[model samples]
Target: MARVLHNCPAPAKLNLFLHVTGRRADGYHLLQTAFQLIDRSDSLDFDTRDDGVILRTTAVAGVEHDSDLIVRAARLLQQATGSNNGANIAVRKNLPMGGGLGGGSSDAATTLLALNYLWQTGLSRSQLMALGLQLGADVPFFLFGHNAFAEGVGEQLMRIDTPDHWFVVIEPGVSIPTAAIFASSELTRNSKPVKMLDFSGAYIRNGRNDLQAVATKLFPAVAEAIDWLGQHGTARMTGSGACVFCAFETRDEAEAVLASVPKKWRAWIARALDEHPLSHLQ
Candidate 1:
C-alpha cells in the first residue's frame, strides 16, 4: 500500500520591526528585522508517486498555478537533488500574497523540508536552508523555524524568544511590490543597530521599519491600514508590505478590533507563536 501523507502547515510571519542599516556594493540592502510566527497558516500535503516530478496545484482563488512558489520550489528541489522519486503536492493557501506575511516563502520552505524527508534525501537542515536561500531570502529563515533576528539581505538569522501575544493583522486589499519599495530612493538606507535586549524593552517606541514611510507614501491603502490599526494599539508594517499588524494582550482584544475592521479590508486574529511551524520536523 502507498503511504498516505498528512497535512503540514506553513505559518505566516510578522516582522516586529525592520530597519535597513546599509547597502552592500552588490546592491543588496543590509537589513535588521525580527520575525515572529503566527497561528494563521497555509497547508500542504504530499504523496509519493513513481512519476519523475509532477507539481499539482491547489492554490487560492486568483492565484495562478504557473506562478505559485510552491510549484517552483518543488521543481527546483527535484532538479537540484537529481532524485528519481516524485510526489504529488497539494497546497491549501490560507495566507494572502503580497501581504508581507511571507506566506509564499513559507510554503516554499515547507515544500523543500517535507520533500527532503519524504523522499529520503537525508539533507541536513543547513543544507536545506542553503538551498532555500536560492529561492528567496525569507526562505532560509522559515527553514530555521523559530522567531529570529535577521540581517544581511535578510539571510543571516539568529534565533530568539519573543514575548507571547496575539495579533490583529489587517490587509488593505492592496499588493505592494517589494522590489519597488526596495528600489525607492525614499527608503532609509542607514540606521543604527540595536541590541535584542534594547528591542525587548520598548520595541514599539524604538523599532521602526525604514521602508514603511516610503511604502505608505506610494500606497495609501497601507497608510490607511496602519492608521486604522494604530488607533487601537501599536501598529507597524511586517516587511516591505501592504499588510500592517498590531499586538494585543488577549485574543479577545485582538478579535474586537478584527470585528471592527473596515469591510473594504481583510483582517485576521492570530496568536503569536514563538516557534516556526516547521520546528517539529527533524
Candidate 2:
C-alpha cells in the first residue's frame, strides 16, 4: 500500500513590517521584514502514487495545474531526487490568493516537505530549502518553519521570536498583483534599514510597509480596509497589499473586532504560530 499524508497545514504569514532598502540591477527589490507565522492555513492531502505521475487531483479555481505552485514543488522534488514515485495532491484552499498572506508560497513549501517524506527522497533540510528558494522567495521561509527577520530579496533569514498576539486579518475583496506593486514608480525603493535589535514588538505600530502607500493609492479597498481595521488598533498591510491586519493581546479582543467588520469584507482571527506545522516533519 502506498503511504499518504493527510491534512497538512500550510499556514499563512504576516510581514509585521516591510521595508525596501534598495533595488538591484536585476530589478529584484531588496527587502527587510519580520515574517510571522499564523494559524490560518491551506491544507493539503498527499496520496502516494507508485506509477511516477504527479497530479493535482483537486483544482484550485483560477490556478492551472501546470502553474500551481503545489504541482511545481512536487515536480521539482521528484526531479531532484530522481524518484519514480508520484502523488495525487489535493488542496483545500483556505487562504485568499494574492492577499499578501504567502498562501501560494506556503502551499509550495508544504508540498516539498510532504512529498519528500512520502517519497523517501532523503533530502536534507538545507537541500529542501535551496529547492524551495527556486520556487519563490517566501517558500524558503515556510520551509525554515519559524518566525524570522528576513532581508535581501527576502532570502536571508534570521530566526526571531515574535510576541504571542492574536490578529484580525481582513480581506479587502481585491487582488493586488505583486509585480505591479513592485514595479510602480511611486513605490519607495530606498528606506533606511534598521537592525534586528530595533525590532520592538510594537514595530508594526511605528514601522511601515514601503509598498503600502503605493498599493493603497492604487487600490482604494486596501486603504479602506486599513482605515477600518485601524479603528480597533494599529493596522498594516502584510506584504504587497489587499489584506490588512491588526494585532491584539487576546483572542477575544481580536474576535471582537472581527465581529464588527463590515459584512461585505471577509475577516478572521488567527493566533500567531511559533513554528510551522511541518517543523517536526522536517
Candidate 3:
C-alpha cells in the first residue's frame, strides 16, 4: 500500500511586543518580541510521488504557485536533502498573507518538518532549524516549536512559557508593505533592551511595539483597527502589520468584541497557544 500521506497544521503567530533596539552594520534591524502562537492555522497535506519533485498547490486565494512560500520551501527542502523522490504538496491557506501573522513562515516550517519525516531523512530539529533560517527568520522559531522571545532580526530565540489568553484579531481591509515600513526613517531603531524578568509585570502594564507608531502613520487602517479594538481593552499591532489584536479574559469576551467589529474588517478569536502546533514533531 502507498504510504498514507500525513496532514499537518501551520499555526499563526502574534508578536505580543516588538521593539527595534538597534540596527546592524548590514542594515538588518535588531528586534525584541514575544512570539505567541494562535489557534487559527493553515493546513498542508503531503504525499510522495514517483516522479521528479512536483509541487502542486491547491486553490489558495491571492497567491500564485510560483510565488508561494510553500512551493519555495518544498524546493529548498528538495535541494537540501538531495532526495530522488519528489512529493506533491497541497496547501489550504486560511491565514492572510502580509498580515504579520507569520503564516508563510509557519507553512515553510511545516513543509520542512513533514518532508523530513516522510523522506525518512532523520534530520534533527536543530538541523531543520538551520535549513529553515535560509527561508526566513520566523521559520526557525516554528522549527523550534514553542513560544519564544526573539531578537536579532528575529533569528535568535529563547523559549519561554507565556500566559494563556484569548486574542481578538482584527484585520482592516488594507495590506501593510513590510519593506516600506522597514525602510521608513520614522521607524524606531533604538529601544533599551529589557530582561525577560523585567517584562513579566511590565508587559501587562506598559507593553509596547516600537513599530506601531510608524506603521500606523504609513497605514491608517492599522491605526483604525487598533483604535477600534482598544474600545474593548488593551490592543496592539503585531509585527509590521495591518492587523491589530486585543487580548481578553475569556473566549466569550473575545467573541463579544468580535461581534461588534466593523463589517468592513475581518476578524477572528483564537486561543493563545503556549506551545506551537508543531511541538509534537519536535
Q: Which candidate ranks first by lDDT, i.e. highest?
A: 2
Q: Rank the candidates by TM-score, best first.
A: 2, 3, 1
Using TM-score, give the best candidate's number: 2
Q: Ranking by lDDT, best first?
A: 2, 1, 3
On residues 85-113, what C-alpha lDDT tens digit does candidate 3 reach at each position?
66788887788887989998999999888
Error of model 1, residue 152, in angstroms? 0.7
Task: Report RMSD for candidate 1.
Answer: 1.8
Report lDDT per candidate.
0.84, 0.92, 0.83
Instruction: List TM-score per model, in order.
Output: 0.93, 0.98, 0.94
Query: Model 2, 61-115: lDDT tens per residue?
Result: 9999999999999999988989999899999999999899999999999999999
Ten contiguous residues minimizing lDDT sum, candidate 3:
196-205
What value of lDDT does candidate 1 attain over all alpha carbons? 0.84
Give the per-residue lDDT of model 1 (tens digit) for 89-180: 88887888788899899999998888877777777888888888888889998998888888888888888778779999988888887999
- Cα misplacement distance, residue 98 of candidate 2 (Å): 0.8
The clash count of every prediction, one per candidate, is 0, 0, 0
Q: Model 1 compared with the native: what TM-score?
A: 0.93
Give candidate 3 misplaced runs (Cα > 4 Å): 1-6, 197-201
Model with the higher TM-score, candidate 1 or 3: 3
